[model samples]
Target: MSQTTIALTYDNLVNRIVPGPQSLSYFVPLVVLPIAFSIPPWIASKQTLCAVALPIISASLVHAWTVMGGIDVISFDMLLHSYHLLLFNDPRRHFRRILAKTATAEKTRTPKVGSRDGKDESTTPQYIEQPYPAKWSGRLPWIGTLLISMRFVDWKIGSPSHDSKQPDRNPTAPSHLRFILTAILRTLSGYVVLDLTSAWTQQDPYFKTFGVSVDSPLPQYALSGLLPPRLIRCTIMALQVWASVGQQFQLPCTLPVALHWMGYLPDAWSPHLWPTFFGSFRATFTTPNLGAVRNFWGRYWHQTLRYYCSGSGVWLANLMRLPRRSQSRYLLISATTFFFSGIVHIGLVPPEPIFALKSANQIRWLILVFFWLQPVGFAFETAVSVVLHHIGTPRLIYTILNILWFTAWCCFVLPFLGEAGRNLGYWRVWPVPVSLWQGITLGKWLAWV
Candidate 1:
């Protein structure tokens, strides 16, 4: 294989920078968000708070999409952070309500010791302070709850169903030293995986199709032949994009946990807060054969954005006055959530490449269609499963069929997503300081940025 020459330039280095220009000014609203929401409800009505905060959130998102230039994922982060601020409206009310419910459930489940029939008969609020002390009066508790609300993905305040599996939110958090050590290992592993994937992706000409104009025909690369070599190449491209994005998502989950361990971040976070952000995709692969798609997105995928993304759907449903648990309501919520998710993901598309391309609209639509189809795919799986079951299909046959269907579906949609990502310079930039893959492939071990 011929090696692609590595070129270093100031422009390339700027693209790799963590924060874009004027990032500090961009973050001023984010830093102020918690404080704004933390103001005592008695002092300021929720309406007042929303009036004060919504415009800033809107402006931040506008700024991120239009102006933010460095590291593409920052735009995605800014959008999610905005969702978080909106969803959690008031941190004190939100966290207090959740903690109270948790305590109530714990009391109901365990009961006070010696209470008959699992009943807590005490006049006292039993198990109310299980996670932390009730008498722990200080600014620390308030600070912790606010920080936790910021990171909490499970028990999303505004979500419709609230049935998504809640991974342990407040695990026995590790110490600062342990957090740092674990973060180091996690970071190094992620860096290595990304570097190796980048090296592999560098060899694929399919990924190099960056400037296809609207007037020009879309290249039929994947469809050129349905042979094993081409098929494998497309599959590898999908996996490469998958692993790269997963590493980017997983790497950030470590930071909040580390800060929590350092006592800089107060407790009250999500399962993603645990160092175990990476899980085997097969862990959620069992049962309801049609659930492969759902399991892939809901279970195995990093859900850092789910709470806020799904919350938008819930908000829309409430606006329409849909009855909770109704089928139409569920479908509406799911569709809206998926639609919003697609729009937010446009942030991942680097504007630089799109601007250069004559067919920027094509890339935008590809991203939108990819995300908007998620709910449709889930619905289709369900519909097909029902039909197959009605025909008395054997369980084993159905399972095989389900897996094949999912594989074929992936083969159909992943290329569009993968190509958009590649065009946006997803795997092109080298992230790690040193590269073993580069040494093997490019004959050098140093990264340009």
Candidate 2:
């Protein structure tokens, strides 16, 4: 492998930064925008729309710096660009002979299936198989649904006489109006959870209705004496768990219906019988167990990058000549997935650009430790399983211990990231319908908080 090096300089770092030009600091961090969104300013001020723009711009720049390097920026090694993940889908071939044959077949006016020199030949190739879901009738609707989702239209054009094996939506909505109404209610409920959580993070005295402060040492934090940090820290942990439930169950997964009602289309992202823009979360984070650590991340977790983190290893291992059957290879690939998880989570942590720590922020580093080290803990539990099974431990005992192991493991790691970045005093605008959240129950709820 070839190594390259480059020298760093102040010019690119906004030169004279050694002494730090005073006015440049102010200008560099700030952004100003003026807009007229085809609406009268007297009816709704431009400031209302602009409220979300600044923080969004700041977050985008900072997150881009962490994920994609340019200028003096550096992204992590585990980073996988959206298109880079598609490289694996392109097809993998080892033998040069097969590669040449496949290339030649694609170049010519040829049928996908034919004969070459009395031998059965296929453009499909001996090594890699074509994507199955694209060809599966049962799953083909998803592609149409995704395309429709962009425009916010329902997939009413193609009606399948039979639904593929998929569950029906609970609290079945018979009409589009009812579906949208339910989505609005769910969205409001989610915002309430988020608002209460934000208040809790700030340790606002007004958060008393939640009863989190009443039972714990949290009251001491804003009080006169030295605050027990654990009270708030632990409180953050509870807040994160609560927030996850809100996030998973909330209108986020169902709001596409509302968009349809508002003149956008709802894509049939869901199957025919259970049509949805995004599906249910019931299976994603269900009752936890030790063995479920594998299932939780593997089957339950939705793939933002289409399972690239886990499946990319099969491609990488082939390229690296790692034996497929070796336990060591599997463990290495599994740990590498955790590295990918660390990369994604670290991007979510507040960059704290204003802080600009010389040693870098310890909080983010600690939070990353929780993600990067999770596979090791999981690996430990896997070893425990092997030993227990080898010793012929009873299935009942194994199941009980597995649940305890998963619970203890998550409790140990969940708090680090939970308290680190969000505990800061910066207020954020959560995406919610303010019109709904500002009325009736929401008004009372906000007052309570």
Candidate 3:
């Protein structure tokens, strides 16, 4: 009879059980803030009002969440270590050993203590550093080691590197004076231009319908007051632009693995850069209200359509009205892509509410389905075009349908689903006008939160 045997060595165990760099990299993007708010004025000009503003705000919020989450993780690790020590009756140790080894290595690499002129003093005895006392050692458990490994991977993949020996300083700010002056000028210019344009444009009949009275000086002054806040906002915006540019443009110095994994492969990634450039351009030139409906449709729905139907040949076949013999193959491919897209949406949900409630999964599914169905519906309508099509849908009927849809979904269906559904759309949690009013009335409460 053959006997089963198990053999384990320290290195083999470590390799098998210990977390690696890749684990860290995967977590970093989830925790670290993306280069938001850093869009240059030229790029910001390309985005619609909502797109331009929302991303920057969201980035800052994510950064805050990451910082808080890190603190909580650290505190919990400490608690776990304390619990382990109490339960096992084996006082946690081994941190000093690691530190002593690290210290010894550093000493060998560089001159230590009082060694003058970069020369070793042969007169004095060299002492081997001892590990920290067993009782006081802050050794992390195996799980903590894995957590640290994952954090390291994330930092390695996503963190931008700078020369550690060099003093870190803001490259954008030459001095405190320059920073203040720049902020003031940007605020003033943005405000003056906005006010002047509002005054000129308000003379149109459209302004009256929109409740914007150009003749009222009080309203104009109130609007102009929003400019100063932009100065503070610009600092964050500048940082975002710098980070994005560094990440996208300065690929030579970035980690080779990250570039390879992202499919950069020499120059294939340059095409990806065009989106940022085009988005910037679009944000700048596109007027909000003139052809507003068409602009919004193109910017939002068209991109959604293109994104969903990008890989599969079904969209093209459908467009050309071609009937292929392999209907099953097309259906299978479409279904798989749709399912993958749903998974991608779920994956994109921010980490805070990773559970059932507040999960981004539902929104992702809705958005994906909307993109797929909207185009198909439109195509059907186009195929069945009629002479009276221009006036086919009444404005009041459309307005009622929109109200009914919002009420059925946002106010009713979502809350009934689960905690996730209720918390999912934070953006729509409060009416914008009401929120602003509350902010004005309860300034401290608004600021605290």
> Whose lDDT is greatest here?
1
On lDDT, the stronger of 2 and 3 is 2
Model 2 residue 349 CA deviation in Å: 4.4
RMSD of each: 7.7, 17.6, 24.3
lDDT tens per residue, model 1, 186-231 = 6567667667766655655555555432123323543334444435
Model 2: per-residue Cα lDDT over 1-449, one tens digit each = 01212244543233211112223222222222112122223444434434543444344444545432221111222224211222342211110100011333454545533232234433433222122132346233433332222211321211131112112232343344555456567655655666655545544432212213322454554543454444444455555554454345434544555565454752222221143334333432233334546545555444344234554565577688887667676677777777666665554333332222222246557556877877777678677767776787775676667555655566666655543433321222232334333455346433333
lDDT against the true structure, per candidate, is 0.57, 0.41, 0.30
Count of clashes, each model: 0, 5, 18
- True-structure lDDT of candidate 2: 0.41
Clashing pairs in 2: 152-264, 152-265, 152-266, 153-265, 153-266
Q: Write the per-residue lDDT of candidate 3 for residues 331-414, one digit (tens) a residue.
A: 443453444343333332333332223234454454355334433333332333332245575544544443333232222222
Q: TM-scores for all candidates? A: 0.69, 0.49, 0.25
**Candidate 3 positional error at 405, Å:** 13
Best by TM-score: 1
Rate residue 354 of model 1 by lDDT. 24
